[model samples]
Each structure stands twice: as structure tokens, then as C-alpha cells.
Target: MTIMVLGIFIAVLTFCLELYFKEFVIQHFHSIADQMVDKNGVEPGNIEKFYSIGYHNSLIGLIIILVGFIPIYGFPVIYGLISFTAVGVVAGYGYIMDYDVIKTMMIAFVPHAIIEIIPILYSMAVGMYINKNIIKRLYLKKNNTSKLGTMCKKGMKSYLLIVVPLFLLAALVESFITTFLIDRYL
Candidate 1:
């Protein structure tokens, strides 16, 4: 919840920043956003493209879970911030293209972005939980192995069952529904 709000703040801030420093933001940050926007919309019948998106999204979730084991309590927070910074930059660049911010968000992002964000944030939460426990055990001398093991087990179960499926669904929505809306409305 905190990370999601922060991401939105970063995105809105970036949008406002882009409004003032359009040239600078575009010069430095537009390419990433452009690539994301461009690659997001695949040909209507491209199963391969949909699979590619799902694969990448799942890979990201997997990495987030792995990152949780790093024994750094704030590592997941850093990852979330870095991930959302790109989102912010993307939002900012969309403004530069003369797209109404609300319309673009409503049409292009609101549908699948929420679906996509949930798994990523949940993955981060899982990572943060594991990382926090490990840090407590290792650095704070908590000596709670059983608790840590239980947490790990839970994280694994949720990741395999929940996060992976959500990513696939989000990818499907993004590749099909969101893309169609973008073409039709935005």
C-alpha cells in the first residue's frame, strides 16, 4: 500500500515535472517510456507477444521474490521505488505527447495496470516479509528459524499460485483489452 501510493506520487510528480521541463525529461527519459508504450501493443492476434509479456512479468515477480532473500530490510522498498520511477517517467512522457493525463490514464492504464501492479506489489510485500525476518534472525539475533521457515513456505505458495496467475491475466488484459482500447480511444 505504501509503495503503491509512493509510485503514484512519483508518477504524478514526474508528470508535473515534465510539464515544466518537457525537453529535459524527454531527452533523458522518453526512450524507456516510448519503448514500453510501443512494445505493449502487439498485433491483435499475436499469441507470442502475449506470452512474451506474461513471461517478462512473471520473471519480474520471480526476481522480486528472490530479492526478498537478500537480508536487507529496505531492499524491496528500493526495488519498488526504482520500478515505479519508470512508471512515473512513462506518465510524464505521455503528457509530452499531448495526451490528456486523465484520459490517457483512464484509457491506457487503469484497466490492466491495477491488475499488473497488484502482483508486483504483493511480491514486494512477500520479499519484504522474508527479508525482515532474515534481518531479524541474522543481525538482531532473533534466532527464529521456524518462523522464518514458515514465512518462506507461505511466500512460495502464494507466489506460485497467486502471483504467477495474476501476471498472466494482466498480460492478457494488456495485450488484448488495453491495446484495443488504446487503438479505439487513445
Candidate 2:
């Protein structure tokens, strides 16, 4: 209960912060996009396509981490597994394309990646907790809230309090870390 409450607080606070700094966020994203394009020698069209793919991938991670509440116990673990696997695959692809360049890119990214991944892990932990309740309700059908209305409301609140903050933290880590790394290393 306490953890859930804290998550909710963090999520709401983060959401508000994101809104307040919307322009800054946009500028940072533009910079990152520029960097990726230049470093990869991607054309404008290809850059757009790659960005779209990345956006979809991010959405997938967000959705899975959010909907993971449906399963309860294994949801977070499964989400983590999938997320890491996806990262690994992408990293491998990057390496295959240009190993030395990719290694440099990874170094440039590691500082921010550490911060960005923390919130994701936190969200997965929350999702796992919710998943446990879902499984309990499914199998035991005991001591559980049965109404869809109640569940939806609860789920929304939980998501708002947990997942939202995580998204914001990721943005922050990306913005600040990327800027710092680029100025220092690049």
C-alpha cells in the first residue's frame, strides 16, 4: 500500500514536471535525432523511418509494462526479460552494422542508460505486484475485487502513480545524460 502510494505520488509529480518542461524535452529529442542521423549517416527519410520504429518499440515496452497487471506474479519478470532481449537484439544489430562505431555509441550512451533503466525497473516491479493480484483473482477467486469498474479505476490510479513517473524519469535521464556525454566525450 505504501509503495503504491509513493509510486502514485512520483508519477503525478513527474507528469506535471514533463508538461512544464515540454519545450525543453522537444529540443532534446531533436538534438538526439540529429546526433543519431549524423552518426549513422542516415538520410532524412531514413531517419524518420528509424524514429518511427523506435517510437513504436517504446510504445510496445510501455504497453507491456502497463498491461502486465493482468498476470500479477510473472508479469514484471516477463517484461524485464522481453525488454532486455529487445535491447540485446538492437545492440547486436548495431554491432553487426559497425562494431567500433557501435561500441563508441554505447560508451556515449551508458551514462544515461543507467539512469533511464532505473525507472523502467521500478515500473516493472510495480507491474509484477499487480500481476500477482491478477493471478490470485484468477485462480483463487478469493478476497479479490470482482467488479470491472473497480478494477479499471484501481488500475488507472496505479498506472498514473507508477508508470507515468517512470516515463518522465527516462526522458530526464536521456536529456541530461545525453547532453553531458556529448559535451564531454563526443
Candidate 3:
């Protein structure tokens, strides 16, 4: 819960930052936002497409976890800047493109993005906590195999087992629910 709150805070903050600096942000991250409509435009038509999408989203989650190695800044890099920024940029355009912002966003965000982002946030939280523990242990000059090693092990497990599966679920939701909602309603 705490991790989600912190991550959401950062996510909103960075989203605003991206929105505020539209000119610079768009140039650097236009593709992230731009590709949503053209690329993931509609829902998957077949089971194979869903499977492919699941793997693709899972791969993205893995990449975010790997990028979370920069001590304390990894969380922001993935959640704040990369993931949310793309969505926010698109939503910004969405506001101009459509009058019904709430419905537009609901069709775009719910089911998939929610599921996908939550675990990534948890991963960031785990990574940060593990790094903090390691730093604390180093400061205290304590060395225990089960302690630090266990922490690192646990963090990875949480990310891999917990987050990845959730992402796969999100992929399924995206391919099914998101696509359905968009196709039917939008």
C-alpha cells in the first residue's frame, strides 16, 4: 500500500512534469505516447494475438526491472518518466481530440494499464527497499548470508513471480477487456 502510494505520487508528479514541458517532453518521448493509437489501436482478434501481447508486456516489465538498478532513481525512470509520461502525453492530446475526457480515458486506461503499472510500482518499491536495506547493512558493518542475500533474493522473487504474472494478467486484460471496451464503446 505504501509503495503504491509513493509510486502513484511520483507517477502523478512526473506526469505533470511531462505535461508542463510538452514541447521538450514530446520531442523526447513522442513515440511512447504516439504509438498507442496507431500500434495498440484496437483489441486483439485471436488467442495468438493475446498471447503475443502478454509476452510483449511481460518483456516490458522485465526491462523495467532490469533498469531499476540505478540505486534510488530507478523507480522514477520507469514509472514516473517512461510509463506514465507516454500515457499522459497521449491523454493530453486526447483531451483536445475528444470532449468526454473521463470516458475516453476510461477506455484507454482501465483493465490493462492499471494492472500493468501496479506491479511495476511494486517492483520499484521492492528494489528501493532492498537497496536501502543493503545500504543500512553496509553502514552497520553487518554481514549475514540470510539477511542481505535474502533481501536481494526476495526482491527479485517479488518482481519476477509477483509482478511478471500480474503483467501477464494485465496483458490478457489489455488484449481482451481494453480492446473490447474500446471497440464497442469508442
Candidate 4:
């Protein structure tokens, strides 16, 4: 899949960049970690944290869907940004902690990342589906509004039934299980 290739590319690029910009990358990772904490400098309780993570991811899914309207440039750019930023943080963690990059990712990132990445890729796929329909309508002189409307409705139903719930599950896993794994094993 295109999303998988793009995510792998971004992760590799970020890991390579980390070799050169270790300090900068680690600083950004710390800043991100800081953002996860509350004003009192303590992490919020699991329930509150789960809600926060779920809300943030759902907001991103909504934005990705809305950005599908731009037809060409919007989706890929946003997708790459999200992928690279996340991978970069993992790379930074590897650097600061002096762990094998791939191993660290497997142990600390993979559990929740597997769940989180799926809905994101699904969002991108939906965006691409919309783009394909738009291109067919505009560039190819195909006025298939009925078909497009049907597809759009299907996409919306799936977004509600599938993507949103997956993101919340991913958030729950990330907030609770991933944290425990990192603390206990990593």
C-alpha cells in the first residue's frame, strides 16, 4: 500500500536524520513528552488521558477526511507530516536512551502503533477514494454524481462505524497498555 511505503520511507529518513541531528531530535521529543503532561507536571489519570488521546486522534481523522476535498496535494502532505513526526520521536528515544532503534520501536512503539496506524491509513485511503472520484468528475469529464454520492455515503458510514472506534481503541491501548509496557519492559 502507498501509505505503508510512505510511512516506511519517512521512518527511515527520520532515523537517518537522527544520526546527524541527535540533540535537536531529542529536544523535540522531550518537548512532545512535556506536552503530554498536565500543568502540574504530572501525567493525567488514565481515564482523562485516554479521552485526551482519543479526542486528538479523532480530530486528526476528521481533518484528514476534510482535507480530501483538495484533490491532489493536501492528503499526502499531511500524511507524511504525521508519519515523519511520529517516527522521529521514536528515533529520538532510541538516541537518548542508547537503544537499538529497531528494537526500541518493536518494544515500545509497535504495540499501540499497529492499532493507531491502521485507522490513519484507512483515513488516507478514504481521502484518496474521494480524490479519485473528484478527478473522474472534473478532469475526465465524467459526471457520475450518483455513483460518487453512493461512494461518499458508504465512506461516511464506514468512517463512523470503523475508523472512529479504531482510533479510540488505539488511544486506549496507547494510554494504558503502551505506557505500562514501556515502564515495565523498555
In order of lDDT, best first, we have: 1, 4, 3, 2
TM-score of each: 0.81, 0.51, 0.65, 0.84
Better candidate number, 1 or 3, judged by lDDT: 1
Top candidate when judged by lDDT against the true structure: 1
lDDT (10s digit) by residue, model 3, range 54-115: 78766665556554444454453444335555455556555544447578778867667777
Give the higher-TM-score candidate: 1 or 3: 1
lDDT of 4 by residue, 1-186 (tens): 765777778777766777788777778768888998879998788789799989988878766766766667456346535755677657766866688777777777788779988788778777767767776777787886437677678778878888899999998998888778778876
- Candidate 2 residue-wise lDDT at 102: 58
Show how many residue pairs clash in every candidate, following the order shown. Answer: 0, 7, 0, 0
The 10 consecutive residues of candidate 1 with the worst lDDT sum are 37-46
Find the 10 residues in a row with the least total lDDT in model 2.
Answer: 85-94
lDDT of 2 by residue, 10-115 (tens): 5445445545666665566467768766456864453354344445445544665566556556756555545443344334334444446455556655654565
Kindly provide the TM-score of model 3 when superposed on the true structure, using C-alpha atoms: 0.65
Q: Which of the two candidates, 1 or 4, achieves a greater TM-score against the reference?
A: 4
> For every candidate structure, what is the RMSD over all alpha carbons to the true structure, in angstroms?
3.6, 13.1, 4.7, 2.5
